[model samples]
Target: MSRALGIYIHVPFCKQKCVYCDFYSLPRREDQMDAYAAALRSQLFETDFSGCEADTVYFGGGTPSYLGPRRLAALLEAVFAACPIAPGAEITLEANPDSAGDPDALSALRRAGFNRVSLGMQSADDGELKSIGRVHTMAQVRSAVEAARKAGFDNLSLDLIYGLPGQDLPRWRKNLSA
Candidate 1:
């Protein structure tokens, strides 16, 4: 029997870089997206995975959502065409609230076979978010979550940062509750 595998697709594009981020990401380079997507698809087709089935397909990076729904859908289509995916596979996309809060986009992504969404919710405090150089606000996070749910995503997760500058126990608790 073939073994199950987890496939991770990285999108190294971001609207802007966070102050504390050390990852290799480019800011506001939308022109390169099409070429990048094509290269990624080519790589997928060139790779040999004859005896394995993908159980999870995770799109992570500068912010997968920054790639936009159409590009993401195209990439996902390529993934399906190139690999043997297991039934009920978990297809997740890592998104920032500012980019992924659109209900129409979320719906399109859901229709494109993405069943899970992981949102970057750095902090509930606007000041903390700003301090971290996050482009999204706490209200955007809330809206994104609501939009994701409305778009038929039942599996939703959030990313949080603790010990941020000026972050205290009370603040952390507030973030948790938020």
Candidate 2:
């Protein structure tokens, strides 16, 4: 199979930054969101996607889903305008469970053309989540997953981290089983 080009958009905002994470992200600033979106649009428009058809478009960063559905849609539109995204192209958005507020938001994101939603669940254990400075509880992760599924997103993926401080194989297995 031939390799295809992938486009990545960074959304540098999060509800709260995890202690283990060193990505480019800040707490949500309402005033800066619009400006950031505009800047992203301009950057997308000015860039060239010559000689490449993007087979995948990934929104990754501190938290792409933090931008909410309307802004995410606008960003997707700008990306589509910039290049020809292959039919059935895998478009994935990285989201934190703590940040996924309402089911309607996920539905709106689906309407915006995102077929895949990747949630940063990190761990299924509440203690592990707290130890990692993740603002979400295990219940929140379950809720987020249910919300995503209800929003018609079947291609959902969850991120998990192992080998954390004081974590053991048994704990990892339990987490994985959960």
Candidate 3:
């Protein structure tokens, strides 16, 4: 019996660095994208997966969607070329709504084989969004979600933060309701 494995890719870029974020990320640098993509391809090629059959490929990080559609497509191509991903593999990408304000990016991601998308919505209230320094507004988050659905992504997840400075149960419930 062959053991199924998982592949995880980390994209370390964001449109803007958040105040409370402590992840590996840098502000968007268009010049660095191509070089970073090449490095990622090289890394995938160098990695040995001789006995592993990947059943899942997760693109995570400071903001995987920060790479946009083109880079993400290139990276996915390189990964597929490097390994044999199982049929019906769960390919997921983490995104920040602010970074993914463009609907075309989400469409391209779905076309490139990502079946799942995780969005960092953080909060549903305008004040909370501002307090957390999230670049996107609550309206933007809703729009992003709608865009993802329109892009044919049925498996979508949103990330919310609890235990925030002023977040009480009511706020949390309201967020949940939204």
Best by lDDT: 1
Better candidate number, 2 or 3, judged by lDDT: 2
Candidate 2 residues lying further than 4 Å off, grouped into runs, are 1-3
Candidate 1 Cα deviation (angstroms), residue 43: 0.4
lDDT value for model 2: 0.87
- Top candidate (TM-score): 1
Pairs that collide, model 3: none
lDDT of all the models against the reference? 0.95, 0.87, 0.87
Cα-based lDDT at residue 14, candidate 3: 78
Q: Estimate, for each residue in 125-166, the C-alpha lDDT of model 2 and write its tens digit.
A: 888888989888989888998999998999999899989888
Ranking by lDDT: 1, 2, 3
- Give the Cα-based TM-score of candidate 2 against the true structure: 0.94
Determine the backbone clash count of candidate 3.
0
Task: State TM-scores per candidate.
Answer: 0.98, 0.94, 0.94
Q: Candidate 1 or 3, higher TM-score?
A: 1
Model 2 residue 34 distance off true place after TM-score fit, in angstroms: 1.1
Which runs in model 3 stand beyond 4 Å of their true positions?
A: none
